[model samples]
Target chain A: MHEATLAANVLKIVSRAAAGKENRVARITVSVGELAGVMPAALIFAFNALKKETPLDRADLILIKEPVTACCDDCGTDYQPGPFPYHCPACGSRSFRITGGEEVRVKSMELKKEI
Target chain B: MCKTDHNHLEDIDLDCLVQEEDLRHSDRLKAAFRAAGVRGIGLLGSPGSGKTTLLEHLVPELMKKRRVAVIEGDLATDNDARRIQAAGAPAVELNTDGACHLDASMVETAFAELPEPKPELLLIENVGNLVCPVDFPVGEEIRLAVISAAEGEDKPLKYPAAVLRTEGVIITKTDLAPYVRVNPDKMVAYVRDMNPHSRVFLAHMDAAGKLVTEAADGGCSLEDWLLG
Candidate 1:
C-alpha cells in the first residue's frame, strides 16, 4: 500500500536525523491528517514490518490524528467540518476551503542519549 | 547498571525534518518538472468512470491547440496508453503492477520516458481508485476528479477526500442517468456541498463525437473551465 512508501520515508528521516549522533531512537511521533488519505493503522503496520533490520527496530511509533478544519471564504469563518457536506455553520455557506487535516509529517521523536 | 538505565531520554523536535529536505520523492519530481517547464493535470476517479474515455476525447482536442502528453496509471495494462496514442498524442503507461495508486516517484520515472520537446500539457490519468489517489500528489499543477452518474449521488459524501481536494469535478456518463436512475442534479449538489470552491461539470459526448459539457450552475463548458 501507499502507506509503505510513507513509512519508508519516515524511517529515512529518522535515520538521517540520528546519523553521527550517539543516540538510539526511543520513539517516533507522527501526525496524520484525517483527510490525508493515510490509514494510521496501515502506516504502523508497514513501519513495524519494514523497521526490522534497521535502526528504527527499537523505535515505538506514535501516531496522532489531526481533525479536518475549514475556513469559509464568504464569511471568513473557521470551523471544524468533520467530513462532507462541509457547510460553514456561521453563514450556512457551502463555499469553504480546507485549512488543515491534509498533512503527514513526523512531528517529533524521543531519543536515548548514550553517554 | 544496565545500558538502558545509563541512557537518558531526550525529546527532539523534528519540525517536519523529512519535509525540510528537498529529498522528498514528490518534491524532487516537482522540481524536475518545474525545470523542464512541464505542467500536469492529475485525473482521479473510480474505474469505469470514463476517465480513459474522457481523455480519449480531451487529448486530441488539446493536441490541436498545444502539445499534449499523457501518463496513464493503471494497476496492469497498456490499454489506456494505446488509446491515448490513437488519439494523436504520445502516451506513457506506468503500470503500478498491483499498487492501488501512482506516487510521484512513479511519475518521475514515466516523465523520463516521454519524448523530447516537453509537452505543454501533461495529463496524468491516475489509477481509477479515488481513495488512495487523493493522498498522493504526483507533481500536478491541477487536480480533477471524475464520477459518473451511474456511480450514485452519494459518492462525494462517501469519498470526501477525493471530491474535496480536487479543483474540479467531472460528472461523466450523463446519458446513462435515466437507465441508471441516478439524479444528476443531486450529484452536482453533493459535490457543491462538499467543496463549493470546486467547478462542477456535467460531461457527455454526443453521437457525433462532439463533447457536450455544462457547468453545474451553468456558464462555461468543461473545456473553458479546464483550459481557462
Candidate 2:
C-alpha cells in the first residue's frame, strides 16, 4: 500500500531527528495536502504499524490536513477546490496561480528530555 | 558586559531537520542523474495501458541511435526492468514495495547502483499509476502519459491531472482498435477539453514488432488556443 511507503519515509525522517536529542518524542507535526493524495485514515494506520518497535513508538503524530485552495492571481479571489477541480471559482480561469495548501512537510517537534 | 545581554536569547528553534534530510536525499538523486549523463523521460499511466509493451519496442530503436538506460518502478516485481534489459540497455528496477508512485529520493538510491551516465537518454517507467506520480517531480525533462484504446474515451476528463501535467500522451494498443469499441475522436475531444496543449499519438506494434507512430503534430484545440 502507498501508506506503507509514507510510513517508511516518516520513520526515516523522524528517527534521524530523534538521534542525539532525547529518548522520547513528545509529538511530531506533519502537513498533508488534499492534492497530495494522502488519506488520513490510511496514513494513521500506517503510522501505527511502523512505529511499534521504533524509539519514538509512543510519539504522537499530529497530521495537519492542508486545504486545497487557490487564489486568482489576476482577480485576487480566494477559491476552495471542489472535487479535485483546479480552476478559479469566480473566473473559471485555470490561469490563476496556486497560493498555498500544497505543502507536505514535517514542521516541528516537541521533545522529551532526560533528567 | 554579559549582564546587559541577559534579556534572554528568545531561545526559539523552528528548525525542521527533516527538511534538510529530505533535501540531502533529493540531492543524492540529482547527483546520480548528473553522473549518468542521462536525461529522464517519465512514462505514467493506469494499469494495463501497454506502457511496458510500448517501451519494449521503442527502447531498442532509441538505443540504435543513442545510448539508453531505463529505471523501472512498480509496486512489486522486476518484470518491466527484465523486459527492458532484454531489449538491450542498462536498466534499474525499483520495487516501491507497496507505494503507488516513485519519488525523487528512491531514484537517488537507484542511481547509486548504476554506472556513470554515458547514456544520452534515460526512460523512467513510473509505477502503473496516474495520480500520485504527477505530484512528485523526479528531475525529468518530459512526462509521457500512456493510455490504451481499451480503457475508454473519458480518461482525459477522469484524470485531468496526469494529462494536464504531461508534455505528451501516447495512445497505446492502437493495433487492437478493430477488436475494441473505442472512439478516437471522442478521446481527442476530451483531451482537448482538459489539456489543450498535450500531444497525442497513436502507437501500435508494427509487423516487424517495432513501435510505429504516424505523426506528432496534433494537439487539443483548446490547448492550441491557449498556447497560441
lDDT of 1 at A96: 83
- What is every candidate's C-alpha DockQ against the true complex, given to 2 decimals? 0.64, 0.26
Residue B152 error, candidate 1, Å:
2.3
User: Candidate 1 on B1-228: residue-level lDDT in tens?
Assistant: 123343477778785733343236667777777687777788999999999999888877777777889999998989999999999999999998898888887888898899997787889999989888877878887789999998987888888888878889999989889988988989988888878878898988799977777888776776655554
Residue range with the least summed lDDT across 10 consecutive positions in model 2 chain B? B1-10
Poorly placed runs, candidate 1 (over 4 Å)? A113-115, B1-7, B17-37, B207-211
Regions more than 4 Å wrong, model 2: A12-26, A71-78, A83-86, A96-102, A110-115, B1-24, B31-36, B74-79, B85-88, B92-117, B131-138, B154-167, B174-202, B205-228
- For model 2, the local distance difference test gives 0.69
Q: Which pairs in model 1 have colliding backbones?
A: none
**lDDT to native, each model:** 0.84, 0.69
Kindly list the per-residue Cα lDDT of model 2 for residues B1-228, writing each as its tens digit. Answer: 111124321121233432344446545665666666666678899889998887777777777666777888998898888998998888899998877888887776676666665566777888988777776667676787888878887777777667766777877777776688777666765665545556677777778877776434544431222122
What's the true lDDT of residue A101 in model 2?
A: 55
Candidate 2 deviation (Cα RMSD)? 6.4
